[model samples]
Target: MSLRSSYYLPPQQLRAENLDSPLGLHTRNPQLSWKLRWNERGAAQATVRVVAAASCSALLNRDYLWDSGELRTDATEITYAGATLTSRQRVYWQVQVLDESNRITQWSEVTFFEMGLLTLEDWNSQATWLGNHGITVPLYRLSFHLDQVREDICTARLYSTGIGYYEPRLNGNKLGTQALAPEYTDYDKRIVYNTFDIEKQLCSGENVLGIILAGGYATRYQYGTPVFRAQLEILYHNGQQQLVDTASGPWLVSPGPWRDCDIFNGEWYDARLEQRGWDAPGFIAHEGIWQEVKPSNPCSSTDAPKGELVGTYAQTVEPPK
Candidate 1:
């Protein structure tokens, strides 16, 4: 008398901020998560239904913009508040879990998130602010070319910021090791930006975008002004939009092996000015110094655009490390 007990298994990894179907997800309150495997193994969570859209047939024709509905609250993450998502805006979501014997699980697979630059005028992106500024470990090189116009990218975003630790590369690989990224905010009042999902790091025309910076804690404890900002947006397939920003035109600022990264003082690499491969894939830097990225600071319109400080409304951690 148990034909799978009337079945209700669906609900698998539909994350957002915790990232699983993430793409450009620079958090606009985005949290929503999920996971449920059953054969009747404690199948809890009595209800859930999330729906947000701008596409995917307007999220299965509900024509939704936001619909939390069910929610009996067993909560996996859930914290998006509905409407107001800007930059690149690419929403699309889905969820429907209702177990605890109520049995109802079949709407869990569509997920999306594209939005990035939440403010600072959504950064018109003049794309400057790069650096070498002495000592080393700064290497920056950006080479671009990705036309393929019949539209086929369909979303590929990567924003950036750095005063300290950074590591990025495409075309020649090396993107996620996930250490100390564009994090550690408080830089003049909240300056952190990171959103990636290069659509499998992109391919359709020559591509390159390498950067390397050091000094953590935004410059350990003293001399500061080591800056970098980058942006890459490609959402084609006919809709049109291709931007490979930052200082807008020419870049190649080298100085590797970090002569002094100074996180607290103690890192000076110089394998004889090592430049081996330099992250491969069509490498070119006939010899450094082509710079144009400026402004490591002094761009504050009122700072606080980390997707409005990522939240369900609760800010207060005065040293709760």
Candidate 2:
């Protein structure tokens, strides 16, 4: 990780940059009340708990606000949960101590933080699996890696078919399943998908994308079937689109008592295609057909060569939409 200083305050040494804020404050009331915010990876279903202690019990308050716009009155500890705050969100807190006359005595500085996001390692793992199985093949599939920027927004989306299932993570936090379906028959009916708007979960320079494809068969004969295929139509957000397809085989057939029967002998193939400089998108599949769409050119570069070991870690980055 790299560090960059945003602005330096004179009398009070404070620095603010990206999603991080390091500040120092001094007060004479023997109690310090302030709010801080930071980004968290994959905390979609958890709560943010804030605990504060002061030299005097009177310093604790019944009127402090802990990021979720709720009054902190029940106890010195405040918990924000059961809403957007529990999911991927940014929180800002404020502490105010009242004097003997019920007037505001002191105010603590404000800080910010983001929660529930993925990490670099998370993204790498997902990318590795996709790359190994030709899911990240350039022109064939829309190959993408995660990046961290100084933006105040983060989000993600997932889509699939055929009893699709997935475990999505942002930064390093697991965001839970985007889709869960048990039966898949037609191409359109078999699709499962999820999307997340996570602008609040983004960090300065660390982001991750973790995904699992759990709807494919485990037969030895179906080993080489391209169970997962994704294509990126446009590089930018405006024209960007994704096409995915998944399939399984031989679920009902069985071997005879005296002989081993190969119920599924044909191969299964999945492919995605994208032109480097052209807007023309392409795709091809050999399992079955859903709609009467134009078949992708088999000889096009979008298709990976058979038995070829595509190298991992080869990826390109584009600005987020």
Residue 72's lDDT within candidate 2 is 25
Model 2 lDDT tens row, 189-211: 22212223434443454333333
Question: Per-model C-alpha lDDT, please?
Answer: 0.66, 0.26
Cα-based lDDT at residue 123, candidate 2: 19
- What TM-score, computed on C-alpha atoms, does each candidate reach? 0.32, 0.24
What candidate 2 gets wrong by more than 4 Å, as runs, is 1-151, 154-164, 177-185, 188-190, 215-226, 229-321
In candidate 1, list every pair of residues with a backbone clash.
127-246, 127-247, 128-293, 129-293, 129-294, 151-237, 152-237
Stretches of model 1 off by over 4 angstroms after superposition: 1-51, 54-66, 70-135, 140-144, 150-153, 159-164, 167-181, 184-193, 196-208, 215-253, 256-259, 263-284, 287-321
Overall local distance difference test of candidate 2 = 0.26
Backbone clashes per model, in order? 7, 40
